[model samples]
Target: MSVTAPAPKRIELSLPALHPEQERILRESSRFNVIRAGRRFGKSTLGRHVLMNAALQMAPVAWVAPTYKRLTPQWREICATLNPVIARRSEEEKHIDLIGHGGEIDFWSCDGGGFPGEGRKYKLIVCDEVAMLGSDLERIWTRSLRPCLTDLQGGAWFLSTSKAASSYFTQMYSWGQGERPEWKSWQMRTADNPYILPSEIAAAKQDLPAAAFLQEFEGDAVSFSGSVFTNLEQAIVDAPLPEQYERWAQQRSWMAPETEFFIGCDWAGAGRRAGGDFTAFVTMAKDGTICAIERFKADFALQRVRLAGLVSRFRPAAVLAEENSIGAPMLSALRASGISVQGWTATNATKHKAVEALALGFEEGRVKIYDVENRAVLLAELMSFEATSLPNGMTRFAAPSGGHDDLVVACFLAYLASHRPRVGECAWSPI
Candidate 1:
């Protein structure tokens, strides 16, 4: 009896095709590979292709994003291509047990509970939209996911767009820039995706804002519009101070001082419920260098105590508190505490002017900071700053929606009020 020929082995593979960048990222075998590109540039598509291949090889892969909603669309795309049978299954049957047996893909968001439980370990973990993940999630990734891969001889693949230059994705980019023992990077723009239609790209460029076009389509690190301090890297220094260095912080007391100092304040009212702005206190030396900076939320007694503490700690020459709702009360409180304080009102002077002055200091390399924390907050706020004009023919400087500018506003006020030579004044005036 002739035996029927065994049915041809079924090879299940899910991927349209591999592009050059995808090939490089997949074949490198590095411990880390950062895939940075613009939106709709096939970043997720390439990520799915690599993950599916790894899973087919019996490598347990984990896919994650900032949230479940962000990962769902790509999860559906991957499911349709890799496991049509599973995809067609009813939602009730989509549980992990049913999918795991069929070599199906499992997706999750970067929430507290999304991490794998005790039983299973992932061989490869792919993090998408990495920029949006919180710092706590990053800690989980390094502490949990990285170690799991060690036993499986696997690596992680990071896929994301170029978010803010100070975001987690940028941090990864910085790490990849160095020669790591096991890591690599692959960057590309929307133009790199051959499959994307040119007409579509042109349409996007026409419809999107200039900043959005550069960041999402061209993959350029363009700064946000109307930023008060555009060049923060130049304004802030990260170098360590010399052991023998001596300056303002050393020979200063809050009681009184021979050298004059200017106090810059950004007052916030309506208490914490208002969520409008912060109460900031900044003390700058006459030479334009920052001596002391203090920031706190909108609290009456707490802010007063903090301001009093600052005055008693570093005797400022004059306090310039913003003349907003809280300014009057704050000034009164400082006065009651025996602190020298004054109210400074922001006038028709455009936000651009103040920012330009700060930018000039940065360009001249005159701006310096004693601590890095305030500098970081200031940089972030500077990046988010924007200019807007009111209906009454007045322009104002403000932070972008959902942005923080407490430190920046304080810094700007300090820069504006700090002592500067008159436009035509000379150091050696003729008697």
Candidate 2:
């Protein structure tokens, strides 16, 4: 008689049932949903539960986190929840059975190679600690994951603790905050997790720094203490194009005759990636008000020439262009072409002092920015700006990774070069 194959066994998860908030998330069918909760609040536990449910229901799922190194513990925790029969299989064999049976979860990390090609369509995706993922991760989800989910009636789930108020995570939170038919949001604090002991909360409060306690335990988006620009929200204005420029110009025109105009230039190179960013040429009058300006963001030389033309028309009192690498070449080319430009050495002292001065100016409401298409990028950088203390006890503002401070740097240089106490008489120019 021929031997027969043993039947495959079904594995049941031994975890507790979902809580009210967890059940709410499970019932949600929105295309996008975010779960903002503190640690030990059952966010990841609920995520794993949902993944198992999707698997049992014959839905493909992907579990993504910031990095594989950080995801190992989660994987082990999830595996521990699995029945012994499934957990005993070799890793490779286990994946095969999981996919074939339709009760499986695949792991992905933002730092890993692109999405897996497992020959199975994915119906659900769970992103953990989303705040720690790089901004480009959003593009990955939009470009690759979104299209892959087309046939599965799939949805993406995001779980993260609150981050700085302007980070990628915060932006997603804001996006989900709006009334949209396709999105849902749920938030909870450490206090909401009954599993956490009261003594644990008190201990965290006593041990962790104030900002850390507020962020991790309270789920609050508080700026770090010692931040130079603590009241950054007030500095932001929602002025849209041409109108913002016109209004700013009118304001500058009202200044005294002796007021000097300063233009700060941060040049971009000649490569495609480089061309994507403009040669940011920002103009500011002596009263710390931004006046006329040009941002040459496109690739063609004609755009640069047009930008140069705008500079000529503005006739700023002084043009301070950074003279390193591509910037030096661009400045030389512009000056050679009769653009009366002055090269400002970006020494360590000058750069440091410039940023400090700009911080003071911003605090004092002496600086203004014209409304433009690039305001979002500039504002994000400004809001995320942090101050680091040196051994000499000096604090310097710098952008965090995934952040851009080119405009901020240019503005600082402009302020440093033109800053002077308001005198009785100032020259005013119309551009």
Candidate 3:
């Protein structure tokens, strides 16, 4: 770890010295500023300056994070910087009233789909680590947060290191590059910060994968490089299928009473790993259209009940599950509950074959799925699906590190179940 200079005995409400890149963007004249900066590029420091300037002028401003936990340090620093001017403070609500300047700064989190900032207005809003909001970032910004700024004719600062499946942040960055007016963007790399040693960045380059380093250290807005399934978007049907063949009434609801559907079950561990993923259920039609997708976390009893319900609803022609570790027992239990379930042991060859069939469906324009709000989870997993080639001439399939692929596995299993039918162990054939 890099060492830091000790804090002085006295506290002062002065901005820290900024490196050239930070200093440059700090003076930008733009209404909407999107900044993509690598780790340790002094983004927080520059944000402090911006907030201080706004508060000093008595401008109403707020700081937002994807989650509340990340706001603690920012809250402390902002409070300390403006302590002498703070007329009142609310520790519970995380808001402050400035005395000398009459400015007010409110701290909020977008943890609940952009509801925290509802019915409020701000002259300027700072969104830190906006990318961590994931695919919902656009929905939050456009549907909710953007309106908050309109009342005050205000601006926003969207800042982050690349951290999402979508290129929304990158699109904003492009807008700053002469694509649109009233916007400016900057890309700052860790090496640009004089304080971060070159050796540290070099070490990071070796430690992280190329794509991850570009995002985390270089601030490059990169999409996935090794996505196993290409053309996932082409298969997305944004509207609900017509009710003539649909079973449910609600938007994106799963219902196909007149047709055959397959259920794919990707079981989760029975408290095997800390923070393990959910057991994913993918219901797919024989024509490569997904009917419904459900995912949840529970013990064997709860899982059985959930599966039994789905089994009763669709009466799926076949139920295919991953047969490894807990999968075997779960399949047996599901059968004991009178749900006929088949198990497929996932070997590298078997996975390759199954995934290839799914990929071909996309290429052939045969795979189609509903674009539901909850379906974003599955789409994200599919988008970030990675395939790394091994020395043995085989490809490994999984999601990026710090992500879950249970949905993707279940999806392929559902796809496989539609085309390939086996009595016992799952055997693959080209669809």
Candidate 4:
């Protein structure tokens, strides 16, 4: 009897050609590698290659993200790239077994609201988008994933786009590049990607807000001035409004004809990307009192539905929304849905005007903010807002890098819409 030997471990895999930076990362000998790269720099692709290589070497691996929803695309990419080598797969558990190798790859979320994969040991671990993983990252790594690597003397990889200089990702990168003998790091920009176009990067540089452009394209950890709204004080901001003020303001029947409420929205895009910008809405009374402020991290369609619901409930006098890329189309969609929303183009001049108007209201103690939580958010953003003068005499107003000004923007638009000059009202009149 002749027993045929098991077919030689035949492996066939195809991936996009790696750029020089990716090749350098792959060739590095560091047990712990950190990549601080701008968005669209092919970090994910490199991460997949790292994880797959470890698996083929007969090591157990786990690819983790902040949440499972965010991990879906990576899982798809892995399956598509390794179809021939995958012996079996489990979608529910996000696990895959490689043919002829006693190896497996498990895709998991850090599972922030629930338990992360705690007890299982892994030879390789990849944490993608590490900066956006929030403040729980240290705990997740130290208390959970770290122990899993002890048995195998395994390696780990961290990948993220730049957020803030104060962010934990930056902190880790700093340590890895200095004190840690086991760790090493690489920093690159989106423009470094051979697949991306220089014109595209230039357009992004011109189109995005300065802070955002620096963080998203240049991979800079930016830090700037203190809060822009100097007049913000607890005495004025935390003052209590009437009983059930928010409910009364949100319900249309309780509104008086003369009591105009304006809504300002900073819409997110069509939800094409994960962890994208949030859509924020601030509702204000004509007298400059904040009634309600809501922020949603959703796509354009869902945000429009939400806006329509708000319009029906509040019967706002005017809806002032950003009229830039996503905003213009969103305004059209809302109009098509029978909601009358006005679009305001965001430029240096318009932004300064609106922000200054809001600041003046705060200074005059005319802006009454309600709800302690919402008040905190608005106050935080306002405090972080900055106005810097360029060499050419142009002043730029924006939030700090990696920080959001959505609530502040919404507030400014709402303030602008409600405080417009009356027929005989003077531009210099008291706010």
**Per-residue C-alpha lDDT of model 3 across residues 51-168, encoded as one tens digit per residue:** 7788777888889887889888899999887887788999999999987555899998877656487768888888888776765577777877788889888888888886552447
Prediction 2 TM-score vs. true? 0.49
Candidate 4: pairs in clash: 227-383
Worst 10 residues of 1 by lDDT: 422-431
lDDT tens per residue, model 1, 186-240: 6677877778898989887765545546667776655444644444565554664
The local distance difference test score of each candidate is 0.61, 0.62, 0.76, 0.76
Better of 1 and 2 by TM-score: 1
Which of candidates 1 and 3 reaches a greater lDDT? 3
Which sections of candidate 1 miss by over 4 Å? 1-8, 11-14, 27-29, 84-104, 112-119, 207-209, 222-431
How high is each candidate's TM-score?
0.50, 0.49, 0.54, 0.58
Which candidate number maximizes TM-score? 4
How many steric overlaps does candidate 3 have?
1
In the predicted model 2, the residue pairs found to clash are 256-426, 257-426, 257-427, 257-428, 258-426, 258-427, 259-426, 259-427
lDDT of 3 at 219: 85
lDDT of 2 at 15: 70
Error of 1 at 88 (Å): 11
Candidate 3 lDDT: 0.76
